[model samples]
Target: MDLELQTERLTLTPCTDETLLTYSTNGYKLGPHIGMYLEELKKDASALGWGVWLVIDKQTNNIIGDIGFKGKPDNEKSVEVGYGIISTKQNKGYATEALKCIIEWAFNSDSVNKITAECLVDNIPSVKVLQKLNMTKIKNDNHMLYWQLNK
Candidate 1:
């Protein structure tokens, strides 16, 4: 599915092969980690339906980052979400708005019972984002914090 999610200040477009290639090859402002995500999309069939998405600044009309599910929901009807914003776009609450939009979309599906996320424990901003979304701190390890929001 070609999914495009819009928030108050951003537009999130699903990362298709053509778009990913263009962003990776050209001097687009996306992060380098996107290449790995592109490879994962290529290898996973589920990614075609619910994978990487490009985050755009609606006001500037520039791609600021990306957010998406790791894959389709599991047998447990749960799925994991991940996101990133370029350094220039951080601290604007754009990530939070985009996440709220995506979470709403995911939960709207009957197949989804819960949404999950993991972030570096030391990344206070990301931790705050997860907390702002009301996702419970389900677990944590030496380096990462795991969060979940049940529908």
Candidate 2:
């Protein structure tokens, strides 16, 4: 995957097996969930753009966090997005900026017509990010708030 999304202050790099291995070798700790995503990619090469994208801070040239979809778009052409920023990077607009870039990229694809996201009810910052993206609140269940934005 040669795809890279650039923002004013961030660079979004889609993760591949080689990139993940390189990052790990350089001491970037990937969580277990990320490992699962890697396994998914290994099983299906087409999962590239649909999996994790590392969030790199432009100034520092360091991975500050990650943001991406859980998988490819479904039959309805809808995909779910998820994101995280390091505690030190939280409260900054990085999540919003990165997500905005990725959303545009996804919507530009003919395979994707809608983007969905979910966050814990108590996650105020996540709620604000979704609201800023103009994703409508669609459901609330099991303490999770589901949101969707149609292209």
Per-candidate count of clashing residue pairs (backbone under 3 Å):
0, 0
Could you list the CA RMSD of all candidates, in the order they appear? 2.7, 2.0
lDDT of 2 by residue, 1-151 (tens): 2488899999888877766554432334677768898889888989988989998887777788899999999999999999988888889999999999999999988899999999999999999999999999999999999999999
Which 10 residues in a row give candidate 1 its minimum summed lDDT? 21-30
Stretches of candidate 1 exceeding 4 Å from the true structure? 20-33, 36-46
Candidate 1 clashing pairs, residues 3+ apart or interchain: none
Cα miss at 11, model 1 (Å)?
0.7
Error of 2 at 54 (Å): 0.2
* TM-scores for every candidate against the unseen true structure: 0.84, 0.92
Which digits, one per residue and each the tens of the lDDT, describe model 1 over residues 90-145? 89898899899889988887778999999999999899999999999999888989
lDDT of each: 0.81, 0.88
